[model samples]
Target: MFITLATLTDVPELTALINASYRGESSKKGWTTEAHLIDGQRIDNEGLAEQMEDPNAVILKSMDDAGKITGCVYLQMRGDKLYLGMLTVSPLLQANGLGRLLLQAAEDYARSIDYHTITMTVISTRTELLSWYERRGYQKTGDVIPLIITEKFGILKQPVEMFRLEKTV
Candidate 1:
C-alpha cells in the first residue's frame, strides 16, 4: 500500500468513498456513520475539487497495489497549525488499522511542513471517535461550537455541536 497526495482529478472516486463512508446505509457497516443524524449529502464532487485546488490544502490518498483508493485524509495549513478533516476509509476496511495509518500520515505530513500543531473538530455526539483521537494524543480544548453553516454541508437532524481537539506536533 502507498499514500500519495490527491489532486482534483481524483474527485469522483474520493466523493464516492467519502459519501459511502459517512452517509447512507453503507456507512452503517462501519462505526463512523452520521446517517441517522443527517439527511443530505456529506460532500459533493465540486467541494472536493475546490479543496484539492486550494494552495494550502492537501488530500492524502491511500491505495493498494492495484491503485484503488482505500483511505484518505484532508489537511490544510491555517496559520501555524494544520487543520485536518474529511478522514475516510472504506467502511469494509475499517478496524484493520487503516484509520490509524492515515492519521499517522497526517501527523507526519504536518511535521514535514513545519507545522507546530494539528487541530480538528469532531462531532460532540461521537464519543467513540473522540476517544479514538484522544488515544492518539489529541487533547480536548473544551471549545464546543455550533455547526451553523448548512449550505456546503446540509441541515442537521439534531442541533450539532463540534468539539475542537488539538495536539502539538
Candidate 2:
C-alpha cells in the first residue's frame, strides 16, 4: 500500500468513500456507521476541495497496488497540535488493520512536521470508536463539545455530543 497527499482531483472518490464508510446501508457493513443517527452525505465535493486547499491541512490517502483508494484521513495543524478528522476506510475493508496503519502514518507525518501532539473529537455515543482510539494511546481531555451538525455532511436525527481526545506524539 502507498500513502499520499490528496489533490482536488480526488474529491469525488474521497467524498464517496467517506459517505459509504460512515452513513447509509453501505456503512452498516462496517462498525463505523452513523446511519442510525444521521442521514445524508458525510461530506461534499466543495467542502473537500476547501480542505485540500488549506495550507495547513492535508488529506492522506491509502492506495492499494492497483491504485485504488482503500482508506484516508484528514489532518490539519492547529497551533502546536495536529487535528485529525474524516478518517475513512472502505466499509467492506474495515477491521483489517488498515485503519490502524493509516493512523500510525498520521502520527508519523505529524512528528515529521514538528508537531508534538495530535488531537481529535469522537462522537460521544461512539463508544466503540472511542475505545479503539484509547487503545492506541489517545486519552479523553474531558472537554466536551456539541457535535457539529451541518448540511455539508449530514442531518442528525438526535442531539449529538463529542469529546476531545489527545495524544502526545
Candidate 3:
C-alpha cells in the first residue's frame, strides 16, 4: 500500500469509503461503525470538496496495489497544531492494521509541516476508540462538548457528547 495527497478526482470514492466505514449496515462490519449513534450519510462529495478548498487542509489517501483508495484521513493546520479528523479504513479491511498505518501517516505529515501537536474530538461514548487513541499517546483534555446535530452528518438517535484529545507529535 502507498499513501499520498488526494486530488479532486478522488472525492467520489473517498465519500463512499468514508460513509461505508462510519455509517449504515456496511459500517457494522467494522468496529468503528457509528451506525448505532447516528443515521444517514457520514459525508458527501460536496462536503469533501468544501473541505479540500481550505488552503490549510489536506486529505491523505491510502491506496492498495490496484490504486484503489483503502483508507483516508483529514488534517488541517489549526494555528500551532494540526486538527485531525475523518480517519477511515475500509470496513472489510479493518483489523488489518490499515488504521494504524494511516494514523502514522498523519503524524508524519504533521511533523513534516513543523506542527508539534495533533488534536481531535471523539464521541464520549466510544470507549474502545478512546482507548485506541490513548494507547497511541493521545490524552484527554477533560473538556467535553455537546455534539452539534446537523442534517449533513445525520440525525442523532440520542444526545451525544464529544471530548477533546491531543497528542504532542
Candidate 4:
C-alpha cells in the first residue's frame, strides 16, 4: 500500500467511498456509520471538487496493491494550523489501522509544512470517535458549533453539535 495526493479523477470514486463509509446501509458494516444521525449522501462530487479547488487544501489517498483507493483524508492549511477532515477508510477495512495511518499522514503533512498544530471537529455525540481522537492527543477546545443543515450536508435526524479538537504536532 502507498499514499499519494488525489487528483480530479479521484472525485467519483472518492465520493462514493466517503458516502458508503459514513452513510446509507453500506456504512452499517463499519463502526463509523453516521446513517442513524443523518439520512443523505455524506459528500458529493461537486463538493469534493470545490474543496480541491482550494490552493491551500489537499486530499491524500491511500492505495492498495491493486491501486484501489482504500482510504483518504482531507487536510488544509488554516492560518498557523492544519485542519484535518473527512478521514475515511473502507467500511470493511476499518480497525485494521488504515484510519490511524491516514491520521499519521495528516500529522506528517502538517509538520512538513511547518505547522505546529493540527485541528479537527467531531460530532459532540460521537463519544467513541471523540475518545479515539482524544486518545491520539486531541483535546477539546470547548468550541461548540451547530450542525449546518443544508442539502449538501444532509438532514439531521436530530439536532447535533460539533466541537473543535486540536493537538500540537
C-alpha lDDT of residue 72 in model 2: 97
For all predicted structures, in order, the TM-scores are 0.97, 0.98, 0.98, 0.98
Clashing pairs in 4: none
Clash pairs, candidate 2, are none
Candidate 4 residue-wise lDDT, 27-115, digit = tens = 99999989999999999999998999899999999999998999999999989989999999999999999999999989988889899
Kindly list the per-residue Cα lDDT of model 3 for residues 59-101, writing each as its tens digit: 9999999999999999999999899999999999998999999
Which candidate wins on TM-score? 3
Please give the range of 10 consecutive residues that has the lowest summed lDDT in model 3. 147-156
Q: Which candidate achieves the best lDDT against the true structure?
A: 3
lDDT for 36 (candidate 1): 78
Please list the residue runs of candidate 2 whose C-alpha ends up more than 4 Å from where it truly belongs after superposition.
Answer: none
Taking the tens digit of each residue's C-alpha lDDT, what string does model 1 give over 93-134? 999999999999999999898997999999999999999999
Q: Which ten contiguous residues of candidate 4 have the minimum total lDDT? A: 146-155
Off by over 4 Å in 3: none
Model 4 lDDT at residue 165: 100
- In model 2, which range of ten residues has the least summed lDDT? 146-155
